[model samples]
Target: MNITTLSILQQEYPKLMEDGIIQSNVPLKEHCSFQIGGPAEVFCTPYTQNQLLDLLRFCLNHKTPYFILGKGSNLLISDKGLSGIVISTERFTELTVEQEYITASCGVTLKDLCNYACENGLSGLEFASGIPGSVGGAVFMNAGAYNYEIKDVLHSSVCILPTWESINSLSPILYLKVEEHNFSYRHSVLQDKELIHLSSVFHLKRDNSETIKRRMDEYQQKRQQKQPLELPSAGSVFRRPEGFYTGRLIEDCGLKGFRIGDAAISEKHCGFIVNLGSATAKDVLQLIQHIQEVVYEHYNVKLQTEIRFLGEM
Candidate 1:
């Protein structure tokens, strides 16, 4: 809308921008992964839990569409720019060790968590040593790799209501915790709503710190050698179709290195759609649609998207 309307909303919702909330109309491309997306109408980074809650309430009251941004690793934002508020959880960083459990905020990256766990002599997170997404995004998608997933070790998580100032709770009003969430394969109950992830508790096993470090190092090296880390990509583009592997299917279809504008299906990994320096969101989306059509035409099974598309499609 207009600046006047935004000003009026700010006046009506003082708690949202009391400290003059961080807003940017034209942020640089390098700030986000994928190196794409136009500009955000308003980009807000709430540092505290209270700040996040207040902003959510404000967005809800104003009927302003908002999207939660984490590491920008598993998303494709429209090149036409986002029309509403962009809420960033990058400031929700907090990590603590309690007994054999590791409690980390949603903004904490998987690499950081794995390193922390290794330093503290904890196991069970070695599988996530090279994962690039943040704790919130990983947990939301039940992210997994190398035979383990977030659901395997997640004890519970704390989440805030999407449109309210309160945290998600049960019928008895129990506070949001990891166990309270209903997690499935690559999915969670929080997926249906716009809830903001606060933090998560992971129950890990105590181990030799040096040994944990060695394993993490090994996994990191393996990932660097295999994954197309040099390019901008949203990990896997499509989910496994039924009993079929997405990568194998694409490979079988001879779709490796398929290009659409600057977007190309990663030949290094068939499951990935990489932005080769100057790919637009439109190009990537078109490539995805093309892959879907071809795969469905040949195999009768429809592949699903694991990446989250934000802003306008």
Candidate 2:
């Protein structure tokens, strides 16, 4: 634990208590979908966009390393762990529907967004009903299943500015900086700056509420049948290579049940890497590397991981 970090956080936000923050020695395994990571130097969850901005600004001013984590569903943190701060957006959840659009804060879950749409008799987000991640995370990776993605429905977003403001609260000055951002597939202009995502606006269509609910239920069932939802795993290990599915290629290489330490290529779905009982970050990394090697050797297709690797190796 960095005493300096803790002291500064306390000074800036008196509302946060020592118990509310996690220390470096505590395992980070519980934070990720893979359940395989060491620890973070400091972990904090902010409840509002203002608090998040304050944290970001503090890190920048002090030259401390920091990370913005969401649901941690698509990440592989290293065994050596993080050297600095890790801020979780879990408490920033706020959802609302205005006319034909659904606006959600960065911490809102995809499942929550789908449920909201279903309740409101809106359609077009059924495919994401089973997606496991935060809205900011979903937008960052263009997360999809059943051939639909956030990019397909996103109207716009409220992205924060890194250098434009010293205070945590948003004002007219912050709004001006937000306007300069650009968005695209699995990316946004915010990626270049330390700015964090505040909320996102998704365009949806009004439809029969019953029909939308049915579709959502169907997608959930399909996911339950196809994915190893019962286990701990990063949903998908690799992106689909152009004209080729990563799962099929891995299966073809006869690596479906391949294991490294406690990490195994999910027998339930070859695209996933699951933790059997206790797995390490190295185990997942080795498994991914072997799969990439074997798949490339057999079919000459290089598989790229969909999961982001974090912390020190």
Candidate 3:
């Protein structure tokens, strides 16, 4: 643990400390969907925009390394854990419905957004009904399923860009239109930018409430039937390699049901690597490497992981 860093944060943000905004030695495993990771040095959850900005400023001023965490749906933290601070947007859960659009905070889950859209007789978000991630995470990764993506409905987003100068004079907040995001297959401009996603505006169309519900139900059914939802695993382990489905390739390589410690290639879905019971980050990593090597050796195509890796091994 970095005692000096923790002391500085507590001292600098006394009010936040008093309010229990900052926490020490938080377990990353409990926060993420994978349920596999060590501890984070410090964890902070800011409920409002101003509070989030204040935390960002403090980190900037101290030159401290920090990570912005959402629902932790698509990540693999090392067993040794993260070194610095983790800022969670979990409490930024505000949602509003306009006539033909829905605006949601970064912390709002994709499931909630889909349900809200349906309740309001809005369409276009049904594709994301089953994605177990936050709005910020979906936008950041251009998360998509069944031929639909966040970029298709996202109108704009309010983002906070970090500046190299002093935090006292913080950088201007940007209202980035969807086109400015430079979205592509499973990627967005936010990936390369030093910005914090605050909220997103999605332009949707009014549709029959029953129709929207039906579509959502269909998608949810497909997800349940095809994915290993009963197990604790990151949704997908690898990106779709051009012109080929990653799951098919892995299955063809006869690597289905392959295991390393408790981390096993899901028998139900070759695309996912699930924790049978007591999987470690090291177990998952080794299994991933082995699959990549075998698949590459047989098909001469390298597989790239879709999930982000955080912390050291």
Models sorted by TM-score, best on top: 3, 1, 2
List, residue by residue over 163-240, the lDDT tens digit for candidate 2. 634444445123312234454535556566655677888889999999999998998899899899999998988887
Tens-digit per-residue lDDT, 1-313, candidate 1: 3365357557876766676665758552544667888887777888877777666666776777778888888888888788677778787779999989999999999989999998898999998878888998888888898878898899987776664434222221224556556777788877876567778899999999999998888888888887788998888888766789898898788999999999999988888998888999999999999999998898887989988787677
Give the number of colliding residue pairs in candidate 3.
0
Evaluate residue 230 in candidate 3 and report its C-alpha lDDT on the 0 to 100 scale. Answer: 97
Runs in model 2 lying further than 4 Å from the true structure: 11-26, 164-185, 192-194
Q: How close is candidate 2 to the true structure, as a TM-score?
A: 0.90
Total clashing pairs in model 2: 0
Candidate 3 residue 152 C-alpha distance from true site, Å: 0.6
Candidate 1 segments whose C-alpha is farther than 4 A from its true place: 1-6, 9-20, 28-31, 164-174, 177-179
Task: In model 1, state the lDDT of residue 43.
Answer: 76
**Model 2 — which ten-residue stretch has the worst lDDT?**
172-181
lDDT of each: 0.80, 0.80, 0.91
True-structure Cα RMSD, model 2: 2.8
The candidate that achieves the highest lDDT relative to the unseen native structure: 3
